[model samples]
Target chain A: MKLEGKRLIWQEYQKEIADDHYFYARSCIRQTFFPGAEAVFVKIMKDELGKDIHDEQHHTSCTGIGYHADVVPFDTTMTVIARQFALMTEAGYENYAASCVTSFGLYTEVLETWHHFPEKEAQVREFLYKATGREFNKPKNLAHASDIVYKFRHQIAAKAKYKLIDKNTGEPLKVVEHIGCHYSKMFPHKGIGGAEYPYVLSGMIEAWGGEVIDYPERRHCCGFGFRQYIVQANRGFSLSCSKKKFDSMEPYQPDMIITNCPGCPMFLDRWQYALSEMEGKTYGKNNNGIPVFTYEEVAGMIMGYDPWKIGLQLHQVSAEPLLDKIGIPYDPLSKFKGKNGEDLGIPETPNYLKFYAD
Target chain B: MQKHIVVIGAGPAGLESSANLSNLGFRVTLVEKEEVTGGHLNKWHALFPSLASGKHTIEAIVKGLNPGIKIQTATKVTGIEAVNDYFTVSGHNGWQEKADAVVLTTGFQLFDSHRKEEYGYGIYENVITSADLEKQFASGKEFVNRQGKKPERVGFVHCVGSRDEKVNNLHCSKVCCITAVKQAIEVKQMIPEADVFCFYMDLRMFGRHYEELYKQAQEKYNIQFIRGRLSESTEDKDGNIIVKVEDTLLGKPLRIKVGLLVLMAGMEFPPATKALTNMLGLKNVSDGFIQPLDEVLHSNLTEIPGVFIAGTCSGPKSVSDTMADARSAALAVAEYLK
Candidate 1:
């Protein structure tokens, strides 16, 4: 049997795996914005991996963003975290996966703090026990979705049926990956596969025959400068963060930019259009900007799964040219293959990328 | 000819003033020294009182802006002179603008935490500024030290830069007390096992929500708020930080060891402001805030005609106050220009 992308990732990075059961703790960002990534992950776990994944709707948002903003009190955030952990423990799962990097970072921080501060932990635990009527400790594994994907890289690679051969060059493509802050900077030590330069996303990109480009602002924050977004009321802050990446990437000109976290992807993708408006410059003649893909979407695409099935069509930034560069033109006018190989036509172009060249 | 209004500082105050003036049918030009426009708020993850994320505040004001206002970022105002009734401002880029009115919204800069050597901010890896914590929080990380270890105990040193007679900064920074309280509570919330302590000279719960927030940190979060200033901090080889200070509340000198130490550095005007004040002939108060003829009556109006001041450039202020000042300055400039 040929090596699949997910399998390749696993072979390179998997430390331990109890794959039968997974506790899927959904992210607030995922539910609010990147629902497609959630749907795709669920589908992958259920259909392909044949794993029993638990996603409790009762689990409220991590509220990390709000808590960090200093808007929501610490006690309120603790209640939410405790309730979510209780829900997971009640479901008979010790392992949990976060869709957003921020959630993972917060969960880990809260848990470590709770474990270290026994008196406070007891108070919180007792309070949660009274409120939810459930005994709970911190989760054993607060894994990001990329963690599992990277763990099972080989399996994912072997599953690829459709190869993304470049039409112009007749070779595998070149790519760049932007790891979100929630994943890398927040906890640099426990990152996926613990590679100094974790090859999780880049490894998969290479498996699909694309080279990962390291740009200047690779480690720079997206300057979503969330506070700046509101208090100062200037669009320039956002533009500057996006421009750093754009200007850096302009010289290298990678075919596409891949990211793991939803927030990073949203800013990078949406800001491209905003940048165009600010600079009065178009990226390409057809104005097709850099396409963004999540680690799962990229892995699934390499696995030869239909684009729509893996939520590729839902991206605000078009991945159409990316598909073309890989020797497969994702015909927007034409239908895409569904799970059962049924036809689902290409999605409507987002307003950000409404104008596209032929 | 369109009456051009030039606004100094691209921070919240500057942006707000420009936007407000532009809305009233004035051609407004806003300048910022940095490449970005949000000011210090951009670096902060959350603010006290409502603990609102900086995003919501930034977006709300930004969304309410007049798009017609021309925003010039990465440009500094080098010289400003009143030519008759109009003000001419020059920039390093050789860019010059003649404004019918000016609003000096130049916000406060963070006091160099390192300058207070007793705090050990830059010297110790574990010793970080409140600004550093804000960035971590904004980046979505929980309150863990640079060592990747969850701190068992954390100490917050208040009034590190503010209210220091030695630094010639005698005025009480209105926000530091509440800010220290808020951070202590957050640390406790993140790590219930972690003991959190705030060493401060006085707990200034002056604002509307300020008192409530301080109480919540004490009553609800169980954070220990000590009314004492930190004397000095030292890091052991273990990297665990030890703080020596008089617990003024207890009136006894005590040593507390903690895994992390955060400095609540106060706000100040940058040195560049002195040059701007001299060149423009704008009167500055003893404490360096731009002085209006009557602060209460003409808070935004400067001594010179056609020039106004807003935000911390005038005096130390909270975010909410600075924003209000920004708008008031805008109205004053707009009314004058009209």
Candidate 2:
């Protein structure tokens, strides 16, 4: 494969991300699955970078999941998105940065719909005013949180306590970046690297000193098709999708997988354990499953944040192997510790995959 | 005084037109941009349907050209201006000729396979275009993958850069369908044990004997013709290409791994032809090929009085069709000169 050709494509997919002052919209799935990702992102923006990012408690879900599952009406979803815009306007911020790829995709779709059909925008305005008595102005800029991270990757790398390099081998870690399909599939121009070869997560991986693996199934879905995963019987199809990715990437023997999408990391992480249980096959080396991480958690880890503090311990596959390879010191006993220094108790361990619970 | 004519592009069309015009006793000057006369014909290994040698074909066409006709190689026409009654054609190499009429047979360029990112043409080592495969065949080396292993399976993806709105080309590139079939058959002949598959949206066997070649591919060569468009291709660890395409007939998705994947890139108007059109203020059809005075009646004549277009520059055409169009254009020029 020609790296120069892919570099040319990556150059074309660069999108405009605002430098500062963002109205942050959190993901419902990210907060539920990997709770620390959004928290670390907010902390990195405000405490680390000293950027003004308002995370409003009043803002609610964009109903992306319900809308994609065909349960929520389009009009209702548009109004909900309009309400989020109302909160952004109310907070006096114009740059809307979404933590979830699905919300970002929904926002892009709604904005495009309004751009094409002004009448729909006017109708949504009436619906929002009638439902919540709120006024809104569309955000001047819409960027995914990973876009912001990608924008600040170099700066974050400069302040890093460790690089995504194996200290033992002195080589850049082979990292596979799985982008959320919704991040760019619906609208290629909206994402950092467009649809075919998205660079949102890979940009972060490259800046943090890792080799990005362009695996065969790199563009495949993470098996979290909103409708497919929501339905009980169709769950197997979702598992198969993730399994396909695992089967394809296994040959490369990547050190870890990093993802920008909320469900992608969760599915790519959890499904490794599930696939091991069902098929007795593991993708990682020496009976260890490949570690999956959100971009935020990866950034936070490289930037010297405590692994336990950033909720890396909550992962199904243990991150200890990667930490040891990178020579990052961690306290294994504090894996289940809470914010107030209390033990949250350990979870059950899988038979095939390695898990740390003490 | 004998009337002089300038023929641009020394491909099949230009060669045929120059020969016909020269035989009719006109002073013909053939301008070729390449060091050699034949355009894409020089690069081709074999012709379709008959699988005749492209070298022999070009030799036959070149043999027809009279010694009286001046053949200027390595001459690229930079500008053509119509004077009061005649025209002056100037080339980049400082060669210029005054002629009573000008014939444009600039031909067509192969679609750049790199434009289709999903196919992984440039990024993948084993994924190549139809033109690239022809070069390999012409090289006389054993058909092998980048690793020099005999490819166990080969795939031919049809209609790339043609009839696809994503790339902004909607017209059917009239020759790629048969080219894929022909190349697939060649691949089978090269590796008799290799599994050859052709993924196509439609099998347009519109030409004579083209349907027979397609049928022979199915019955004799055992080539699998899957009715589908390839969605994307990815490279395996061994440098093989894994293609994902849906079998539209079976209503199912298929993932096939091939040692080599050949993308049947279609034809498009070369930039030189477009520049000529712009220079002459010639009308172009919606598909961007130079428009003729009339499709059926005056296809050889453009709106300009002394300017005529033939071959794929007017539109995508097979070698036979281009040769016929060149002859028709020669007749039109002869009639106008009379």
Candidate 3:
């Protein structure tokens, strides 16, 4: 209710992000689920903004999923992260930008652990040097890819071909920004606006001419707890967690949900369909489900990138509703087309949830 | 010559100390930074255990002060200097006093509720602190939520900033538990039909009559005491606060929607007191409260001979304990001046 008071808290949680020359670390889940998101991010950074972002093929996963699932040991995860740092050092980049919120959190945790215990850093250095025969200097700056987008939000807004404002109603889109718990829950100072009210995605939403909706469950986890979803029986816990968020945000009737985490957008989007199928309950208007998009996808869409090219069609909840509201143009035929214009085949429609093809 | 004693702060501690010092044939000066005396007591509606009016209590304490005792309001102590056997205390208003002894009754300040962001203190319209609730009670206005409607259900969260390692404050605030119980009873008295709930980790009713009041709160008022620390709070569209707390007794997570949620913010040493103690080269404990020479035997005596600490400046204490501490400090100063 008091926007001024929340602004005071947001001002206290600002973090420094490097301007250029970032060594990009790709996420496993993001690349697997929303491949076009990272592609659009790289395209926007290189072609549109002319920023230097080096994405090395040799860089491996940070093993955040396995580590969080309790399958991988802590020491192994540390050395795996050390290997990523080694690759960044070989590429001669000091600023490390992660494509995943989980990776960003893991990197922050490892760095903080190293800062607190130099012996652990020494042991990890030995592990990396012995295994990969590589030396690494710690990154000068650590930032999530969304932090980079937030830092240049004004510039993106200036170059945006279309705003997030509805073309017909002229009202700003009501956007729900669900931040990942790991993004700042462990270390609040590492994130853009602290853990409670992160401003990374909201900052971009504001600059892009969208009204950020402060729902009751704005800070709830997306229910993508690795172990919870990894195990079969515990998957209900995850689904119910996302359901709780949906139930809480239902009153707000947000236009769409935007997220920085790789799992959040996927879970928030997929769970809408799951909930609709399970209980015949739909949160959005007209039996439609709430659309969820990664921050990169939203940025690319506002920048006039084709919706198919940005992979909005891949979402379980149709982005057509949001695209129509924003008046972004997209050919209906290209909804299921492959990169080379081959027919990728349309998926089957659900009973309750609205699908574009249906 | 009668030695002049300067009592910094004009709260109950300072008032009692000045009264006792003046009664012992010493010239006393009571300095308060605020335009009015009574400190936090002025904002409070009633005291705990007995539910006495805070205004009347302060009036009785003020009446006990001899007319010879100089009362200086709105005088902030800028610096204190020890020259030979006498001390010179200078105020921010350019007033000065020479004293044989200085009693530091500079009390504790309430913990800032904003630091616990998960509770949504500042962000949520329905989430307020205990002090804010006290001010509402003292205002004699009808208790209402942000929507200006009488709250159906009110919740009190205990030990907001005390004994919480996340905020780096581990010491118990000692007074918040009783204060929450007192305020909960007051809320019931004001709104008899409204449901009142108290969520606490563990109720520390260590003081005399405090346990009886806590028992009375449950037996008489029907206040629901859930043994759980509040995890977080969110505000609904209707300005009601949805609080998530585990009912430890049931070993299950519980969610309750309350029309108003009150956080029992704890006490910590005020920054002014810290600066004054540091300037005077007095020792402070790890928790940042002024250090007593011996907490058991010589609690009023500081390492510095002429500097004595009273009330919550040394630690968190109830108003009754602060008054007793002030009298003990006055006795210690009298013994030191001998």
Candidate 4:
């Protein structure tokens, strides 16, 4: 399928993305659920590309989950984001790179609010200064890490050891790219290709030699509806939401599902597993379940980084077939085994995100 | 000297305006880009609410065309410049005309449903446009499924390409909501077994007798209305379209699988209209339709003294409204020639 409205031109996709010296703010959900993926992102920025990405210890969370979960008030969340800006200014960086889609969306929301109501911005500044004698400078450009990776996809591809093509058939793998709702929904112009056909992940899929699949549910939210999934009684709403996406994409038989959001990847993978146990149906080839990955994980693999170190084994659905399909050599015994091939017995995980050593 | 007026399109507006202006004893030249000239009205299977044949309506309008009016077919207008006393219009194929006044009735092109990629118009097999549905109805295919079986459910999604910030179009396509209501009734009449649903952000029943049709759709046809914009559409393994929408009325997210999904694509500024606008230096409102000199007082007059706009090229309108507006534009031209 065609990429639709989004062409390969970088500027037409999104306004601007900074290349260096960025103040990186981690996502609460991204760090907790996919910790290794975040670490891999930092590794790629520092070791692989030698870019300066400051993930300072004192940089507070954007509290996007707390805000969306309705646990935190608007003032509290704005203050926390303001505090993060203070941390960035203290570190002398003007570019803000968010690790999570929710945080990126929140950042955009607050920025757009400030644009619409400069008085609200002044209030935020006063609130920040009054809360902690901290003076801050607004970031010049705000970008999601996924957006950065998308901007640099071709640069990384030129150094990649392999394309995202199925090795057996020698054809580009059919990849379905799911953009997080927050990345583009709130303010489309701030997003890649203005939300209609977001080019963020799709551009990377194209750049890395993968055939992008277009399904009707391509733009639907992962249904993480943070509050919906957080409350035990409302989990059905979230599950049914992803069920719609899975049911839609199943007909196309994509080789893998890739998302730019942490919660989306976590939910998409978990829900597919949940759907199988609940409905007695599976979507992946050979009944292994389709592999879902963050753009960071896939980018790392294509960069020829060690998959185990990047925590590919931590996924609920095994990425084993994907690794094998791409002909990336992974020792099955070492999957549960440690780096030194020692038995570090894994702790018991939940039934939904069931892990290795179970 | 004969009072001459040049009309830019030979669609209903041009035909009606040419006929009306010629009746007032003014010489008229009707220019059309296509080899034949019913414009968009020529393609429709039937009109809304009444299910009357659009062909018959267009044929009558063409029959009413004054024999004194000259018809220029398959001609492309490149520019129109207002000379000292009259307007000089130039076109390809060495065609030229001069008139005391000009009327732009370029009409409009239906919004490209493909632009809203989430709806899966071109990508999904089961999804078709409202215009396509009319043609399907015209062909006497009451129920259309690839398997030739009656569909279990049919969905009509309003505003596929209108009033959406995502596509850079913010004006409501005036007739779509009522059109959806009318089409839903037709679907129910065709397949009595099928459940019909209309998903819309808001239903605008502004036209006369339109609200009655909507009431009939609800009371008589038993068509369901969901008050929310359909977020996206996806297909199941069996080629059934699964639509996801937030039922704002009930404050719940809903998904339904339907065998046929109709996207009510809206109207857009046609290239022909834009070409005319640029060539004649006509000003367009923020929504991109040619702006009238005064939206209320001088709805037919353009900023360029004697240039007038008519029909859907001015904005979204129903056929009846367009015909009324075209006649008013004819009067404005007639008044200008005086």
Ranking by TM-score: 3, 2, 4, 1
User: Which model, 2 or 4, shows the larger DockQ?
Assistant: 2
Mark the regions of model 2 whose C-alpha exceeds 4 Å error after superposition.
A129-133, B92-96
**Candidate 4: share of reference interface contacts reproduced:** 0.31
Tell me the number of clashing residue pairs for each predicted model: 49, 1, 0, 0
Give the clashing pairs for model 3: none
lDDT of each: 0.74, 0.92, 0.92, 0.84
> Who wins the DockQ comparison?
3
DockQ of each: 0.01, 0.74, 0.77, 0.28
Candidate 3 lDDT, tens digit per residue, B85-188?
99999999899999999999999899999999889888888899999998898889988888999999999999999999989899999889999999999999
Indicate the docking level reached by candidate 1. incorrect
Clashing pairs in 2: A13-A192
lDDT of 1 by residue, A1-358 (tens): 1124224333444444445578887777655454467777777777777778887778888887887667888777887888888888889898888887778777777776777887767787878878878777577777788777766666666666655457677765657777766664554545653322445577667666677665434555665645644446665777687776677666666777777776777777777767666565544336778777777777667665666556565565667777766645354543345556676655545454444322
Residues A1-358 of candidate 3 have per-residue lDDT tens digits of 7787789889999999999999998888787788789998899899888999998889888999999888989899999999999999999999999999999999999999999999999999999899989999999999999999999999989999999999999999999998987888899999988988888998999999999998777777798888778898999999999999999999898999999998999899899999999999999999988899999999999999999988888899998988989999999988899969999998998888998873
**Docking level for model 2:** medium
Cα deviation of B119, candidate 4, in Å: 2.2
Task: Arrange candidates, best DockQ first.
Answer: 3, 2, 4, 1
The residue-by-residue lDDT of candidate 4 on B50-115, one tens digit each, is 877889999999998889899999998988988998899988888999989999999888998877
Predicted candidate 4 versus true structure: per-residue lDDT over A196-286, tens digit per residue: 5777888899899898887767777787978778998989999988887887788788889889887899998878778877876677766
